[model samples]
Target: MGQGLSCATTQEHGLFSAMQSGDLDTVKAMLERDPSLTHQTTAYDRQSALHIAAANGRIEILSMLLERSVNPDVVNRHKQTPLMLAAMHGKIGCLKKLIEAGANILKFDSLNRRTCLHYAAYYGHSDCLQAVLSAAQSSPVAVSWGYARFVNIRDGRGAAPLHLAARQRRPQCVRILLDNGALVCASTGGYGCPGSTPLHLAARGGSLDCTRELLAWGADRLQRDASGRIPYLVALKHKHGACAALLNPSSAEPLVWPSPLKFISELNQEAKALLERALMDANREREKNILKGTAYSLPSPSHSDTGADDNISEASDTELCCICFEHVCTIEVQDCGHQMCAQCTLALCCHNKPNPTIACLNPPVCPFCRSAIVRLVVAKVKDCDDADQDIGEIGSPKMRKARKSRNFSSEGSSSFKGLSVMSPFGKMGGRGSGRMAAENEWVDKP
Candidate 1:
């Protein structure tokens, strides 16, 4: 019996070794010689050949194992499926193969009671995360568990994937989860302290980008955890001055995505991106004001108005927003056709605080035409050569003034980047009143 046990252990070791090293021929030969080898697992962990291949990113080996009818959903000692291992290790190819082999995505591990989705988010493997989500869309999990429910699925500690992503400071993963409908303000039971929202976790983790994404998706900054601490307090506790500035409820309110509006929800991809960017930029402006004269400084903005592509066009052809006299007019008000810079448009919408009792606030009016703002779309800008024709039409003096601000870029943000010295609403114009008071004073009128 001892000799027999020794022989079996050696065989299992050889097979697992071949799979880990991606030795396709050796793995194939071993499997063929002893068909039971396909089902064999390591001694202690009970991790099978499939788990080894998937964890090590042996795509061809993984394919052969799957073809040999090795169960892709086979669990190890920890009850972690091959799919979970693939996701945890960020083996995208292996993960997809396991999914194709009908590996279960909803299988929870014994360690955390967390599914493959939670593993992906916890480890910050966005590609693996996306693959798992895409597979779940068509898999039986969607029907039995519901896609939204799976997205917000909790672990033993009641931490959702969004909670993991935020705690780990995975901005891209957080954004992906939020886009897939992970509850932004969903409270936890024990994860990251009881009743902590993703926002609270993000603050505790000191991730400005993650915090921004949550806030853009309408995360309530005022929501407190069981510890009776808001995200702002969490940021302060962690000494994340930049994140704390943005999370401060006393700071100017950032513009949300306005998802409640049917028209807004129906926007095209490009239009939606413009609006989201506008919202982020507007919030960054607020953060700048709060951090001014402080020890902390924000990192530079991601995208910029001035790029190699901008050099292809003449500055003269760009029509400046007459209201701001700063940025190029990018958003067009439909029917009326009045145009404004994204920042100005966002300012108009966010000028007044929405009543909490009301489900949806009335859409703001166009400052230019006094028309009810309806559908907004990306405006077509004139190409470089059309400069002389429309230069006067857009007001040459305003265009010239815009050039000055364009010459001064704020940490490589945009041609018209002036958040340090300007309000998001350009017309606010150093009104001496605080940002909140300045926003309150602005009246949309004909």
Candidate 2:
């Protein structure tokens, strides 16, 4: 027993000294003296000799040690494997060697629940990330299972690998995660900690490249977290001017090659596939509704009334919003001949405007037309709450106050009756006459 203990102590001292000096010869001699010395676990801070070699970036020592069949899977007192240390230290060559030797890519340090991938991502080590992912793909399914599960796995704080990459301002790492099916909007941590989505983290980290990658992966920048802060606001709060600028581009400018837009152009095959799926799902729903006769028909092009035809064509062509560039399935053509998409119009008219009126923004101009479009009527989604609100307030005190405030004629109560015109052009001629004209033209032509 005494001899064995003495031998173990000698092995530990010799190995630790060899690792510290990066003495490959001494390490080889010691390992030859006792083959078990390769597995003799003695870490200064609970890190094995492999961990020391990896952290120190001693590639020769690491290669020699790994050749002796030393378990590269050993973790330190902090549960950090050599791969994690190598990644953190930006030891790309050593990392590659270790990964090739079958190091655990998904090993998580107990301190932060951070994996080797997390360390590589957080430190902006693109080569390390590539090496780890490559090795994971080449290994047996059982060996790669941990990393496969970790793609969507969150830390104790619920932060996915994408979130860590974003938070660390690692644009390439963000791209890798997004390509590997990472969730862009997965929430992490809690309310006080903000429970930020990956977009939020990217914005906060001031990395426009990362933010763009997240957006290209279909992350919703407008979604508010538990604290009601969206990704753009998070960017502004964290002083990420470039990221915020990319997210909320100036309306006046045409947005020539914005960073987010540029980033989106680089989406990999998987991101494109995800987008295609979303678009296809939306199209499928639209087709189903059309078959059920619930879908609204578009105005036909057979109309001869030049003025009205021009208006309809212009409305149809410009119906798609510039913001999201999606077809404006629903619309609220304003009185000023300006036609805007439903969501933008609603946000402008009802939510942001002090007085909710058809002419709330510059005498009811069509958001698109910029003409003297009068308060014709609002076309809303079926069973829309806003439509209900418009109808329900006809005789309410609020309507009465609004009538008095707007100096509206109280003679026939037809003013309020026009509000019931649900069709797009129901009030075309008079106060609400345009509605009938537009609807009749649409219905009769089709």
Clashes of each: 0, 31
Q: Per-residue lDDT for 84-128 in model 2, tens only? A: 888887999889888888786766678678788777877888888
Which residues of candidate 2, in runs, are more than 4 Å off?
1-14, 33-37, 40-44, 141-149, 190-192, 249-446
Q: What is the C-alpha lDDT of each candidate?
A: 0.74, 0.55
Tens digit per residue, CA lDDT, model 1, 295-376:
8776657876555235433544445565555666667776665666676666665432323455565666555445567788
The superposed Cα distance between candidate 2 and the true structure at residue 216, in angstroms, equals 3.1
After superposing candidate 1 on the true structure, give the runs of residues whose Cα lies further than 4 Å from its correct spot.
1-9, 306-318, 322-325, 332-340, 348-377, 381-424, 427-446
> RMSDs, each prediction?
7.7, 20.0
On TM-score, the leading prediction is: 1
